[model samples]
Target: MPDTRQPVAARRTHCPYCALQCGTRISGTRADAVTVEPADFPVNRGRLCQKGWTAPGLLAAPDRLAAPLVRGRSGRLLTATWDSALQAAAEGLARVRDAHGADALAVFGGGGLTNEKAYLLGKFARLALGTSNIDYNGRFCMSSAAAAGNAAFGLDRGLPFPVTDLSRARTVLLAGANVAETMPPLMQHLHQARLVVVDPRRSATAHRAALHLQPAPGTDLALALGMLHVVITEGRLDTAYIGRRTTGFEALAGRAAGWWPERTEAVTGVPAADLRTAVDLLTQSGDCYVLTGRGVEQHRQGTATAAAFINLALALGLPGTPSGGYGCLTGQGNGQGGREHGQKSDQLPGYRSLSDPADRAHVARVWRVPVGRLPGPGLRAYELLDALGEEQGPRALLVMGSNPVVSAPHAARITARLAALDFLVVADFVPSDTARLADVVLPVTQWAEEEGTMTNLEGRVLRRRALLDPPPPVRSDLHVLHGIAVRLGEPPEHYPTEPRKVFEELAAASEGGRADYSGITYDRLDAGESLFWPCPATPDPHPGTPRLFLDRFAHPDGRARFADVEHDGPAEDTGAAYPVHATTGRVLTHYQSGAQTRRVPELAAVAPEAFVEVHPDTAARSGLADGDLARVVSARGGMTARVRLDPTLRPDTVFVPFHFSGDGRANLFTHPALDPLSGMPEFKVSAVRLEPLPE
Candidate 1:
């Protein structure tokens, strides 16, 4: 807990939205009466987006949950005392567990949770509930990139180098990332570099690019393969670096040989000349960076698409160099840290594999639990949701800090699944769409009312400071977890409510693993140390690793591996009935799910409702005009939104922001077909048709 005696004015903290985690300072004594100003921080450099500026609105949101609520006999959620709510929740979960065994209880977490809360939630699920079904929303965000990174580099960090290092690049190739709208402050680092953007629509980021390749949706993998093919045939490969620093070059080279530029252009709808130009821009400059975002990564072949781009970077000797590399621009506040600790189904704290004997032993010893007591790996996020209340599946679900009703792909199905659950518990600050359906809703502290750490997109571990106390009836997630664990018969000492103590246990648990954080202390962070991960405990004062793979990779042989990846298009194909491609993404004013951003008055005014972005020609062809209510219907489902015409979009593609709920919810049109390697759903591309709704 934060010291009450500490001054309440000018307390520094980080934004609650996005992985950039812009530094901010609050200048008031309470949540309802505070002002936010940008603070000097390396990542954002004192700048903030609209979401960051309006983050304080969440602390005093009109819909903020200040009391516990439990469903009564009539299925209406009524206000309940803390004791009654806890007991009801415990009994409900225990009832399901007793009837269907431990695996029948599942846990779902969020990427926005503080490191302390994320670690404890995983521990609580494994040790207290003895359940194997656990996963987080990050599976929908960057799991594909993580999978590709681990396969290629033997490690997975959003960016192995600091975000500032991007400023030194001469050319930058951005694939399916609209950073200008998604993360505005990042544009500052790319101002000096020539931008080459690839997308189906001309996004804010594309508007500023030196070149934009408007490929057909889900054809990003084909584009990348074509670029690699161009690089290989043109004899532009850095043979020396390839031979010295990586393996599997022969297999990758053989694969690339088949994806000639003309053949790729035929499949991707990108011109052969543009494919050659993209390859030239990437390889001609010795200092360049390749970055991918959700556009290319939310597909059935997402991992392969990510790997194809990595293969391009590796062949050009970009990664492991000072001014060049391949990295993923993570989406959430703690997306990097959330996955590092044990929130994923198959991972333990410190990114250790759950199936590895030695890794399991190390974490079990730190947790003070017998190694065999820890349950085995369980279902991924989509699978878990799909299995709700099914035979031999999870009968009860506990969701903390995430709203899957509005965020998950094929969301109508997910909502139905939640409704089918025997018991549901949701911990959130506001009554989000998912929380509205929970059997028990626990009011938990928000970013301004909690103290912990978050790892940013650069792999930089940052301190998240609390500026004000939570409302009297509200509790921190740590406390909620602690209370539930106690009810589950776990000793009080096992689940500490103090963030620092939980971090101490986390550090010890992560000591020898890949994402080691043993040497990082709150004192060190307070002392202004700019620490990155893999900071091991040492007798000598060790500078945290700001950059990785400078000399060697994390693999046993000290060399990166090149995956023999090839292009596999989207799971769904276009036809006469559903000819247009529909893709989903973020808007400048909204963050994930619109749970927090949609509640802000100022933000709501700027972008109050979701609208579809279609080319004028496409709209005209469909007999639709700007501001016309239209239904984008896919085979799975449909969502209705106002049409907004933009000539910059590809004539066959339309864009929708995924933040809105109700009729405007974009995920309704998305598919649950997942990337086999990463379990990431196909949120970006789907085949659909537009129908104008009668006014």
Candidate 2:
């Protein structure tokens, strides 16, 4: 068993990496770096990943942004004073607003930002700039799961129950999530649990599973339907649960009617026998969960795939139960909270819809603005970025925390669109590729040097305490946005520089909304006691809802929903020209864009650069070998990456880590096709051909 200690040290904080948000302590601080020790936080039980241990290297990184940068008359970014930079930024944004109207001033945020920053960023876009064009990079993470969760459960918190509940489960049917590589700290929870993993590649997590169902890329929906088909044919489903707890069973049954085991095998390339075995493992256990991540959520039919999984879980009497259900493994550090607090295209402060009159009225009262003053739904992340420089699109962009050049699907085109922008400003702690392209770059404080709250994958809210002040001239993201808002004449009171105060206002705005955090405060979180949301502001605050749908879902009908979903396959079809299916993921040593992790000497030494993973059979066919330079090509673009042959991968598929930029960015060849409902780009499946680059 893990140490599982509660935080007893000074300056206890969460990791600055993925959504695991492991507890950490600032063990020591020096002029050059901050040392870290694992804290006994509940999530990880005092464990930290390599990236977390060396996260402080970024604080003292040689190239870390410390001053403002402006594109001077000579066409080069030159260091400038805060006043001059703010003046230039204000003048540029004002010019764009005057020429193209408010909608032209778009804001793009990141999932890594704290709840306070995310809330303020959205408020800044609508209340200050008064633009309807605002979204965040989180759209690329698992927005499909979010859409599916809302459609089925009427609410979308990454997990309906706390992650600790997984430890109590007898089985976990994990799909497409490489928890071993991406979130190793979470593996402890599954140490004693039987596992069933689904993926095209034998991912690290899949390799540890009792059963690994290797499906073809982008065919998760078909596989899910097949499992449901088995559960239906074998009488493993609970008809009573289906009738009482959920609706739309007949619709899903009608759709699953045609997806028999044989048909599913042909479509997904998973053996029919193996599929039945997977169903057996799931049905054999009273406590079992079905979870998914970006692999199954980054396709053109991502929402449909997610819905199919929910239908399967609900049919098996899993959801709304004690220790078994479906959940989405949220990616970015603050991906869960970031989406909850209004940075999403269609949401208000509490995951409330923009079109909902009551939601708008409540949030408007918090902002002290008219209900109608808030902008309506804007373009999703991909659409907003793709629409830049168009005739009727955004002319100026304000980016906070996100480094999209290396992270967006079809990043080459995104970079082109960004280049065409009349004006661009990026706020970051480092001078990333995206920041370098900005007309102005503002330096900001990093995670350890900031104070805020983050909601983890379990929907538990945890506090991030400030350890030390950033080097002089480095401001927090809240401060940067506040400065820009003040320059634009927005009142100072509305945009507080203090994180706790911003969170207080955010809580008020979130009152009565779906993801209510109105009752939670920094005071309640003082003793390392994290709270859940939907915590209504009562005299004695609710202990935050750790489990949802036990009594009722957020649906007006007081029941969970199931969708009649069909498999549409991948948006891009494989052909003779681009015969191989290419998929991308992250490496253990690097976070989303490698902006901070890449700067760390230890992490950089472990995984110095990007590489493509190919099966031995595919490598033989292409006359390629391990450690060889290869060019993966698609109609959109091509990227040259070093090849790492893995027998665990499917022969017709190749994998690349999407961390590095420039010549090695995997997003260069990814398809830009968006899911019809969610507008999430198909980053998981793409038609591509490969060739060896001569040594």
Candidate 3:
């Protein structure tokens, strides 16, 4: 093991990938000459994932953008000064708004943005651009879980307790989350627990489980319902806790009453005996946890699926205690914070509703603007992207911190919509696939060159200290936003370029809402205080809330509500024509879109490109062999990948990592069917067919 002792002059910060946000220290003054060592953080202790250890490579990547680029009259991107690029972007956006309407301008954001950046981007879209069309890629990440958590508990903070609390759990139920690969450091907390994994693929996490329930794709809802049915039938309901701390138990029980093990097994493809075993492990526990990830929450009924699991947790009386609870394994680094601030289409800072009169009034006062000037809620991420350049949609767009070209569902469709736009601007440190399509690409500072605060999956806000200065001609996203706001007729004071000032404004804006951060200051964070949120300021230096709902749920009556959720199968079902299910996820070596990790030679050499995970039985049935190039075609599009046979995977299911670009992009085949409540696109399961491609 490497020495973890703090080196003199080393800057303390957090990882740039994943919500673990493992504490890290960099010990060099230059971007390319830095070495990263793990710090003693509560979440990951002193361990860092491969992606976190090799993150500095992103700073010195050979393809790092050095200067702004603008499309000239010849329709080609050429080097341009910051002044000219900002001018072109501002004027183009203004032209669209003047010709069509304020709604003709849109902004797309990402989950990786800092709290300050997320706050300012939402403010810029509303007060500066005077448009309501703003949403981030987090809608695609965990909106379903957010919606369900809000409905059931009246609040959502990913995990309601510090990640360290999981170490004492006797039973840990990981539904659709592969923590062993996605977040290896997190496995430290689960080693003492009796693990139960639910996934179609025998992921690395599943392999470690005492019991693995391999249900068919899109049947997670049914599996959860089956577990609840067993719990109720076996008389394991926590009646005292339920009567005291919950409502709607009878309705929820009635909904699950019909889903006996046999019926559930027929739909979910899990044996009735195995379902009973899962229930036994969960109920016999001293402390238990139920956590859901993207696998179950990316379906058309994503919200309902999450609520079903929440019902199970409540029935078991697991939540609201110090020992165990229900939570969502948030994917992105700032996914929890990005959506809490004003980045989501229907939200304002503090997780306030956009259409709420009181929420509008409070935020308007914070911005020093009239409440009447605040536009109503706009379209969600997929809706906004699908409507790009259409007569009824925004003609111009500004994208920051996301690469939708390879990440969005139905890539072919999103690509066409992007091409149809009148003007496009992308702010990024690297020439990502999305940046190559922009009318103006503004080179921006990366994680190591910027200082800000990011709230991790556990809801702890950590300070990100800059280790080195950015290269010449490259600017920070805050500076770029301030420039554009000034060019578009907003005062410089309204849009501060400094991260501290922006955070101060954010604190005020989020002072009274659900995910309040008013009491959290840079002083407390920099002083190494562990601050989880809903930390209100007016309460006279209140201690930060590391554990939530210890006494009561975040509801008016202080009782959790059990959702009457039911199982609705996949949006698209398998048939003779398309008889297989295809799923997408991340590999250990890469993250969303492969924007940074792919640049690291060490990571790329380990998992250089995308490949399809096929069971040997399925391969032989399709007349394909291992290492053969095959085309996986769905109703929307097709992507080619090398076939790797894995006997552990379900025979009817094929898995592909959604990190590569071009013909290897997994999202090309992902269906755009959205959950009615959360607007989360169905990314977990799609009906697809496989065809052999000759070498």
The whole-model lDDT of each prediction reads 0.91, 0.89, 0.93
Top candidate when judged by lDDT against the true structure: 3
Tens-digit lDDT track of model 2 for 483-554: 888889899888999999999999998988889999898999886556887788998767889998987878
Q: In model 3, where do residues sit more than 4 Å from their true spots?
A: 1-8
Q: Give the per-residue lDDT digits (tens) of candidate 3, residues 256-312.
A: 999999999999999999999999999896789999999979999999999999999
Q: Who is ahead in lDDT, 1 or 3?
A: 3
TM-score of decoy 3: 0.98
Ranking by lDDT: 3, 1, 2
State how far residue 490 of model 1 sits from its true place (Å). Answer: 0.5
lDDT of 1 by residue, 1-695 (tens): 22244446687889999998888997665523667998888888888999888887766688789799999999899999888888888888888888989999999999999999999999999988999999999999999999999988999999999999998888999998999999998999999899999989888999999889999999998888888888889998989999999999999888888889889888999999998888778777667999999987899899999998899899899899886999999999999999999999999999999999999999999988899998899999999998998887899999998999999999999999999999999999999999999999999988887899999998898899887878788999999899888998999999999999999999999998999999899999989899999999999856889999999998999899998887778888889989899999999999999989999999999999889999999999899999999999999999989999999888989999999988889999998999989999999899999998997
> Which model is ahead, 1 or 2, in terms of TM-score?
1
List the pairs of residues colliding in candidate 3: none
| Global local distance difference test of model 2 | 0.89
Q: Per-residue lDDT for 546 in model 1?
A: 92
